[model samples]
Target chain A: MSNIIRFIIKYNLVFFFLLFEVFSFYLLISYNQHHKETFLKSSGNVTASLLQLSSGFTDYFSLKEANEELSRENAYLRTLLPDNKIDKEIDDIYSIMEDSVEYIYRPAKIINNSVNRLHNYITLNKGERDGINRGDGVISARGVVGVVRYTSQNYSTVLSLLNTQLKISAKLKESNFFGTLEWNGKSYQHAILSEIPAHATVSTGDAVVSSGYSTIFPEGILIGTIQDYELISGEGFYNIRVKLSVDFKNLTYVEAVKKINKKEQLNLENRTLND
Target chain B: MISSLGKYIVNFIIIILAQVLILNNIDFGIYINPFLYLLIILSLPVNISNWLLFTTGFITGLIIDAFTNSIGLHASATVFLCFTRPYILKYFAPRDGYEPGSLPVPSHFGNAWFFKYILIGITAHHFFLFFTEAFTFTDFTTTLSKIVASTIVTSLIIMIAQMFGKRNKRR
Candidate 1:
């Protein structure tokens, strides 16, 4: 018994290291599929609220720039509102349908942002209490910014467009051709829009906008313009570089978009896939 | 000197909090996350048992892992560092040998020796971390660049931390 005890004591360090490694390996395997610890995944409600309070104190200096952007967007919308002749023709036909579509915007400030990382996430001031929820779309006046991932009472985290996990459906403004926009984590100023078929007439400065296939964002929200592109040799897809509309480094304010029928649409899709 | 038990507990909490709250947020255009927590392992007393050093390192890293969503990356890297630390220290041991009950801080070893010790240990830690995080040599060039950038930044931060400790001691 004494010999066994001495042997265990002598080799305890190796035993402990192996034990820890085995435990860590188990966690790594589990975390690879899906993170299990929800508590540590994000800051909880209390911490998020504290962050929101802190952001309010810090955001005062940027009010002028935010106001300027808002007024400019207001003026642009006003100009379009007066020229309703084209919209009136479309409304006449759409009036026959029962459901009318409209969108509401919830203004929020960006509390923190990181663009250079492969998996960047942004935090915004608005949260569940302010009508933000997981899967809601967020955008700045410049373009689409990201989608809401987790929300607390007073703050929400966004999976930024620059995150490798994010893939948004975008298309050329002048053509039906579309592709998935993904960040390569190389630069904040550029991203790659892949899977664009070679047959599409893509150019250096073509406009890209949301496809509106998902309820998170409305159709025609400006995403970016292609900066450069190349057709991969022997492949049918084009790797298009896009200049993002939102300057991630200087982003201050954003608007959260809530789609009224998103839950219903998602449920229907899930059921169809199950069949 | 603070008891080893108390020091270990305090260092464990400090490193985990600092890594998660502060260093993890520093993007710096590259993946240059300073794992300053390894300083705890590097600064263990010279007379301490090797087994204790290894245990402390593993625990410190496991706490870090629990916070960052990166499962065992920190744990494995830290364990590797603890394993290599004794060899590195022995290679750099003074001709007269280490002073008894002496800690590994700059005050005991002087700035140059302390700096070298930290640099070697942190390099090993970062190398293991990045390679494991990448888990592939597919982007070998990119991984190599990240390893270099992160090492430079981490070494600078560790030196700055040492300087801060020295300045505080004078105060």
Candidate 2:
């Protein structure tokens, strides 16, 4: 027993090293789950605030670019408004008659962003205090950005569309043929659109937009344009490469979409299915 | 001893800031990522015990991981490097071994010895980090490219930093 104790004591450092390594591996495996829960991600208060502080310093350098994007978004939003009194009357009537859930857009700044990882996440300055919640859809002025995965009091973590685990329901604008949009983990500006029927006419530069099958995003939000595509022999689906519209590397501002009546709609759907 | 402790703490904060703010945002193409934060582990005193070395490595890595959302990848890689550090030092040591209270900076150790030491340490670190991040060998070529490119880039940056840092050597 004395000899065994001596042996163990002599190699205690090795044992401690192994223990710490095992603990790290445990964290890696548990946290890298397929669905990768957002509990321990970058939205933690300290890290989030640190990121925001750094961004505050860096945002100054990009003032010109940011101003351009904001004005462009302003011009687009102006076009979306009713330009005539007749259209305004019709829009008011349409909104009142349509007793449906509406998705409200809340603007937020992206404090930290990454595009060079298998699972890229973006940190936004808006959080629970700004009414940003988990599952809110985030988009840029040009197109889709990501989904809000975690939130603290003043910040939120968005699981970017570039992540491998994210799949968005998308459809072609020309044929309305729908498929799933996925990131190939190679390039930040491109994603893969799969499951479109091989027989569907897919040409280069074809527009792909959200199908609204998932309540997270509204219908017809632009995702990308088809860069190229190939149909594998005897396969039912076309393998398509799409050039994403949103420039993720240059993303500074985004809007978190909050659906006001989603819960009620889901409950109603569930009740009808039960009957 | 108290001054040395304060220096290490300050070094820790500086390295973490450089890493999380500037280095993390660097896009040297898709394959290259420069992790200059490993300098924290490399510059520690030669006489520190094995367990303290490992703990410091873990703490440094945990900070980077928390900021980058990489979870345990950095921590595991840094710990592995720490566990292997002593053996590497032993193999490269001169006849009398490393001088006490001396840092592993190139100014004290000479260019050739420092190059070999840091290359090995950084290579081990980048290899473990990229492989763990991929978590699979299915994309063997892609992972290999990343490991090689990043290792070279990180080693070059560390060498440059060491060259400039030679001026600050304490007698």
Candidate 3:
């Protein structure tokens, strides 16, 4: 017992080192599931508050640019107003409106964002208090941004589109044929659309848009344009390179899209699977 | 005068704030992420015990992970960094040994030794981090390139900062 005690005491430093390393690896393997709220579970509020504090000061430098962006978006929206259309004869003056509102868009300012990491996240100033929730799709007027993953009472984190772990359903606007769009973790300005068949007519400068096959984002949001493509040696699918429309580096404001009937859709899908 | 521990505390807060607020947000492209927070670990006093060293590395990395949302990636790499630091210090020790309270900064150690120390330390940390992040040997070359590029950038920044830092009066 004395020898054992002495040996244990002698190796205590090694034991501490092993213990912490094992603890860290445990956190890595168990909590770092990419989709989970590992970091958010513990010190999220503290870190977020610190970020909010810094962005409070730094947001001034970008005020002019953000104003320009807002004005540009406002001008585009004004062009879509009914008043802008030619005064055509009100055909059936009461023509039934097609497709009622399916999504709720809440504007949010980004407080923290990064594009240089293999997996990146964006922190927004809106959260549960502001009606943002997990799984809400984030989009800029320019393009699709990301999906809200974790939310506190006053802030939330979005899984940026630049992350390798996020796969978005996108379609070639010309052909309407869809495939999985994913970032290659190499460039923030580009993403790859895989699994598009070779038979499909895809060409450079062809537009890519959100397929809206999921409950997160609505259909037809512009994603990017096809920059280039090539057929895989053995696979019939064409791998397409798309230049993303949203310059992530300059992302200042975004909107979180809350699908109104998401619960019903998910529940109905689960029931169908059960049936 | 501020105590030594107080100085380390001040260094920790200042470095972390700069890292999370400014450095992390820099769009320096994919190949040039310089983990300046490594300075927090690099600047510890020479005579600190093994347990203190490990705890400091683990906590510092975890705080960074919290800010960046990478969770355990930085923590694991920093632990590995701490695991190797004492060995490097021992192997590179001068004949007279490290003074009781000296730091690893260029002002305390000579330029060559500080440069070598930070280069090796940052490379080890960056290698483990980038490779673990890639998680597959299939992209061995890509991860290798990222590790090499990031390590060099991080080392250069430290060297330049030291050059600009006020030269401490020689003991």
Candidate 4:
């Protein structure tokens, strides 16, 4: 017994090392699924607060560019708004008319962004407190960015358009042809639009916009235009190159689109799919 | 003892912050992240007990794992390296016995010995880390490439860190 005790004492270091390693291995295997303890997953509050403080100082430097974007969007929206005189005349002509147009844009700033990664995620300065939630579509003036995946009180993360997991339904504006826009993780400026039927008359410089198939984004948000295309023999789909409208390398600010009736539409679609 | 403990704590915080804030965010096309926290393990006092070394390594790795959202990757790799550190020192020890309280750094050990020690320790840590993180030998070639690339990058960073640290200590 004394000999065994002495041996154990002699090799206690090795035994402790083995024991700790085995325990760690057990944790790894047992939690096979991604165990996201959100509290510890992100930067701590103090660090995040410090980052936010620094970002605030940096944001002030970009006020001019941000104002330019806002004014440009404002000018575009002004063109869409009908003249007040025409609206009054039309309302007088039709007493029972109903307003049929509504638009909502939630402004958000990019707190952190990376364009050169395979699975890059952009962190935004808006979150649940600012009415931004998961599945909300994010876009810049140049094109569709991505959908929000996760959110915190003061921040949200968007799966960038350059991610392989993203698939946004898009259609060629000139023709009725449409396909899914997917990033191949190669270049940020280019992506692959697949599933376009080979028979469609698609050409270079053709406009591509959102198909409105998903409730996250509204119809007709600009995605990109076709740059190049190839028809594979014996395959029904066309492999088309797309030049993305947004310059991901220079991304600074974005707008999160919140569809008011998203839940109702999703529930209805779920019921139909079930049936 | 108290000053050493304080130094270790400060080093622990600085390494982790540098890793997550700067290094982790660097996506250099391929996943060749440099894990420099192992310097803490490699810089311990020569006469420190092995159990204390292992425990310190395990805790340091656990702190990193907690921040990076990996369950046991850093912990496993660190334990593996810490377990082997004594054997490596014995294999490469100088003809004259190591001086008491002499810390392991490039200046204390010659450049060749320091390089050898750091290369082996970082390689062992990265091999076990990438292997378990990938969790497969199915794509043996790809995994091997990752191991090689990551090991090279990690070793370079470790060496750079050692130089900087040694210079700072001289001040």
- TM-score, chain B, each candidate: 0.88, 0.95, 0.92, 0.92
lDDT of 4 by residue, A65-149 (tens): 7665784475335224553122333333223122332334567777666665445667777778877787899988777999886
Model 3, residue A106: distance off in Å is 0.6
Off by over 4 Å in 4: A1-37, A54-103, A202-207, A227-234, B24-103, B120-153, B168-171
lDDT tens readout by residue for model 2, A1-275: 99989987898668777988998888788776744654556788888888888887876765847764774465335234442122233354325322432565677889888888887899988899977898899987799999998888888988899898789999999899999999978898899999999889999999999997778887788999999999977888899999999998888878887666777777888999999
List candidate 1 stretches off by more than 4 Å.
A1-8, A22-32, A35-37, A45-104, B1-27, B35-37, B47-83, B95-100, B167-171
**Residue runs of model 3 more than 4 Å from their true location after superposition:** A1-5, A8-13, A34-43, A61-100, B163-171
lDDT of 4: 0.74
Worst ten-residue run, lDDT, model 1 chain A? A78-87
Lowest summed-lDDT stretch of 10 residues in model 3 chain A? Answer: A92-101
How good is the docking of model 3, by CAPRI class?
Answer: medium
Estimate candidate 4's RMSD in Å. 6.2
Question: CA lDDT of each candidate?
Answer: 0.73, 0.83, 0.82, 0.74
The TM-score values for the models, in the order shown, are 0.79, 0.89, 0.89, 0.73
**How many clashing residue pairs appear in each of the predictions shown?**
0, 0, 0, 0
- Candidate with best lDDT: 2
Residue B125 local lDDT, model 4 = 85
lDDT of 3 by residue, A16-51 (tens): 668888988788887656455654432278888888
Question: Model 2: per-residue lDDT, tens digit, B20-136?
Answer: 999888766678888999998988888888779988999888888888877888999999888878778888888997778777878787888888998999888888898888878
